[model samples]
Target: MNQQALVDVAAVSAPCQGALHWVGMEQIALPLRVAGQTIAGRAAAGVNLVDPLARGIHMSRLYLALAGLDNQELSLVRVASVLETFLESHRELSNAAFLDLSGEALLNRPALISPLSGWKTYPFTLRCRRDEHGLQAILELTVGYSSTCPCSAALARQLIQQAFDERFTDTPVTHDGVREWLGGEQGIVATPHSQRSQAHLSIRLANGLDDLPLAAFVDRIESALGTALQTAVKRIDEQAFALANGQNLMFCEDAARRLHQALRGQAGIEGFRLRVVHAESLHAHDAVARSEWNWAGS
Candidate 1:
């Protein structure tokens, strides 16, 4: 069959004449480069309908243009090329192009104090646009961790001290006796509450940037928080994790501040924004906080 002989309704004029800001396909299943590796992902590809009288865009043109991403590592430069091809393919119908890619990346993480390591999945999205304002991109991802509430830790410690005072007021307190008591429920009556938490980060990249700093960002943020959630663990790893929680208890504010400072020191980007969420074990509601640096726009 002659492809051009088939009906092409998109070539016909629209009954109503008006410009549409965006028009194209969304949630297109595709393979994406994430953290320097290829992963199964979905992409939303579109372009602005600048020509008001045009019935619709050449949707096939845009879909075919996505072939540029195949086997290519995702980067701002690579995305710009595909977007440029969108405008070139629709030289008269469109002036702007947009692409959004979403995927989950699995990274191997070592246990806190054990030789065991396991895979951790980080969900991420990369949004790209080419318009009169020039090329723009935003990299966003979520990292999970554990947060021990500082207030809860303090209150639990106070209760333990009170219990000790009541029991040892007349008894001679020795190291062995204190150790035995601490190992029992009577001395360490209450325990602080902790919850699995997550941090959401969005970074605006410089136009000339070549690679996404996802792995680096994950490492820095996890280090700053000091209690990244573990994937596999032994009894020793669990003990080490407990020690870490006890030593680095924080509120939502502290987690956000730590991430803010950590992101401030990073490069290859113009600005960043972060949010930390603590799923509270003590209450039904979650604790959330947000922070940003130079996030207004470029």
Candidate 2:
């Protein structure tokens, strides 16, 4: 018997005619290389269908083109190439291509005052868009930290002072006695409220960058916050973290401002939008503040 040709429905004209802004696959499972490690990742790959009369662009071509990312380390420059391949394959059909790759980036972070360290995961998504203006990449990630409320700290201090005045009314001030009292629970009437906080950063990259700069950016943001959440700690490290929180009390506004300052002048970054969220311990709701630089107009 003679074989018949298979039909391609996607190649046929659509009864309803209009071009699509985005069309392809989402929630695709893929393995990605980040920081020299193979981390499981999910992706959404697509291209713009400029042909209003055509049914669709070649989706299989986009899926197959993603294979190029499997063997190589992920980076803006590298991803740009894959997008170029996507455009080349859909040369006559699509005028733009996009790839959105998401995964958790893991790095073993050392304790504040100990030899111990533990793995920390930063959830991140990288997006690459290629159009007539050329390729542009956007990196978004979340970094967790500890934020002690400044207002709470001030109120706690006032209560502590009131308690001290009442307790020391009759006793003469002595260094050892005062120190002992300060060490006791009665002397330290209250402590400031603190909560685990997160900074969500979306950064646009300048041209000619080779890597994503995830690790470096993580370190910088954590250092600027000064109270990054710790893992695998000794008693000494715990004490140090406590001290850090006490000394570095801030509101969401402070955190947002700090991140903005830290990200400024960072090499390879053109613009960014950052949001700091403080999950309020005293209230049921969260407090958020946002800031952007070189991004408002763009």
Candidate 3:
């Protein structure tokens, strides 16, 4: 039996001829090494099809070129090399190449007041575009923490004062009794409302910088907020977290400003944008704020 040769249908001329702004594959499953960790990532690879008369691009070649990302750790320099390879593979057909790789970055975070440690997964994305002029790269990630409302804390303190006055109106106060009451829920009649909040950070890397600084970004944002969410905790750790929340109270606007200042100080960042989301426990809707810096003509 004679086997029919495989047909290269993508290479044939299109019945309706037109150039495409972007043509390639997306959601391609691939394992990527980034900042010393192997991540399961999805890559969206594409290039501008410049030849209007040409049938179509070689999609398989674009897919095959993504293999370059698997062998080396992900960095701007390495990503630029991969994009160069993509353009080379599609030589006459494309002048620009784009790659977007997204995945969860896992890290071991220790408890605030205990020796226990657990893993935290941060959703991260790396995007790069390469053209004749040069390569532009950006990194994005989300860090979740606890946000305590300053207004709510003050209101809570007022309520606790009222409760204390009502309870101790005639009764003589004793040190041991007061201590016991403080240890119990009766001592603090109300508590400030706190909610799970997240900071979405997107930073454009300097043209000459190659380091991603994923962990550094996370550390800075969490340190600014002062109430990073814990993965594993003991009773002491929970108490410590509560103390942190009490000490570092903030609103959505406060969180956004803090992140803006922190990101602006990073050396690797040329331009940046941030969005802070506080899932309000007191209200039905979420509180949100956004900030951007150094993004003008470029």
Ranking by TM-score: 2, 1, 3
When summed lDDT is taken over every stretch of 10 residues in candidate 3, the lowest stretch is: 69-78
lDDT of 1 at 58: 83
In candidate 3, list every pair of residues with a backbone clash. Answer: none
Off by over 4 Å in 2: none
TM-score of each candidate?
0.94, 0.96, 0.94
Candidate 3, residues 15-57: lDDT per residue as tens digits?
Answer: 8898899998889998987667788999999999999878878
By TM-score, the best candidate is 2
Could you tell which candidate, 1 or 2, scores higher by TM-score? Answer: 2
For candidate 3, give the lDDT: 0.89
**lDDT of every model, 2 decimals:** 0.89, 0.92, 0.89
Candidate 1 stretches greater than 4 Å from native: 1-4
The candidate that wins on lDDT is: 2
